[model samples]
Target: MKLKVVLRKAYDYVRYDLKEIAFPSSLPDPPHIKKRRKLTWEERYLVLKEASRLYAASWVRDIGPDLRPNDYKKYDDGEEKPNEVNGATKEKEPSTLEDLAIAARGGMETLKPALQRVYMTRASAYRDALKSFIEGYKEGVQQVMEKKENSGTQGEEDSPKKST
Candidate 1:
């Protein structure tokens, strides 16, 4: 009696599988994915500002701490005199992103190469993180499918038999 029940269930499963294989178009359409909203100008600026600060901090760390602007003294009568610009001194070491930007005086051209390298490194890291996340998601879906199949088989076995 148990063997008959098992055979009947197996046949039913095979028939269902065959039907699905023959009628692939019967499958429902995938869920619609919402489009991501674009970032506003303020949001873009904030993101850029934060990235610049982080990059600056990392660059400062890699290079030594001595990021102070050079101060050359001018001699009028062979006597050394401290260089001054409108009664202001340029002796402060760059300890903040704004200060670093000011100290760079050479403008964007000078920092282009370093910025490109940093961007490439960050992009690679982001790709790796995204790949790992996708792999994990696939594994989770496979596990859920396996669980559903097992539960479905168990339910068939546990249910009371119907009399004709």
Candidate 2:
């Protein structure tokens, strides 16, 4: 009903509904407010790397514990074992995407849930980029091999043999 109340209501509406508030005309820059800036190329790369590690760690955690490598334990008999019941150790589990996730989380002790979500959002795109890079590299290697094979055989055949 009063001007102050009306002004407060308008400010709330702009802050909440519109998700932004115009600075007062008198101040060119708001005091004590941090300016938001876009991440530079290097910063983005580091963020993506961190996010990927966290995301992978989450996946590794989700996979059943059985697939994860267990630490070797020594028994009273002075024998080491991976499984509890027998002294025999299991053959290493085959590596999977889950393994990659575990490796990515290798150094990190804890994951922040909010940051993990951001990483998860970027993970798919990063994965696609990596896949493309791998494919390109493979193609380049294959082409080099093909050229070597062709050139080696052709050069030998084209050369005149010296009679002994």
Candidate 3:
């Protein structure tokens, strides 16, 4: 008797409950897709330029205190000695942006490597994000195209054919 009751309940669940769950009366609406526009070259340049300036400012602010001129001073009986490296006097570390530029010997060559690394890192990250965005956009476009084709075919099948 218990086995019979259990089998009947299982059959009812499979027949009625499973059908409603698998094929609901209504489905939720599809999500709306929005198009994303690419940035213009001038806008991209300005954004990267501003980001570089901010990054440089923060880098300078963090290292400024450590590079103070007084930190390198040598007191020797009222005479200051220059920093010596391998028995030869070495130039003092620059404590300000102006001093650093001057120390660079009048060209941007000294700063190129560090700035290049920063730009490369930023460019790589931007490239990855843009790649992902483009891939998703393509997928969305494909989905929209498939949906349109499917609907068009269904509409034709459902409508009566008119004689020409």
Please give each candidate's TM-score.
Answer: 0.36, 0.30, 0.33
Pairs in steric clash, model 3: none
What's the lDDT for all of these models? 0.72, 0.70, 0.75
Better of 2 and 3 by TM-score: 3
lDDT of 1: 0.72
**Local error of candidate 1 at residue 54 (angstroms):** 26
Tens digits of lDDT, candidate 3, 75-99 = 6765644432345445555454555
Candidate 1: segments with Cα more than 4 A from true spot: 1-107
Top model number, lDDT = 3
Residue-level lDDT of model 2, residues 48-163, one tens digit each, is 98888766776763433334435333357666533445534555564544445665586454334434755786898799999999999999999999999999999999999999
57, model 1: CA deviation in Å? 21
Instruction: Determine the backbone clash count of candidate 3.
Output: 0
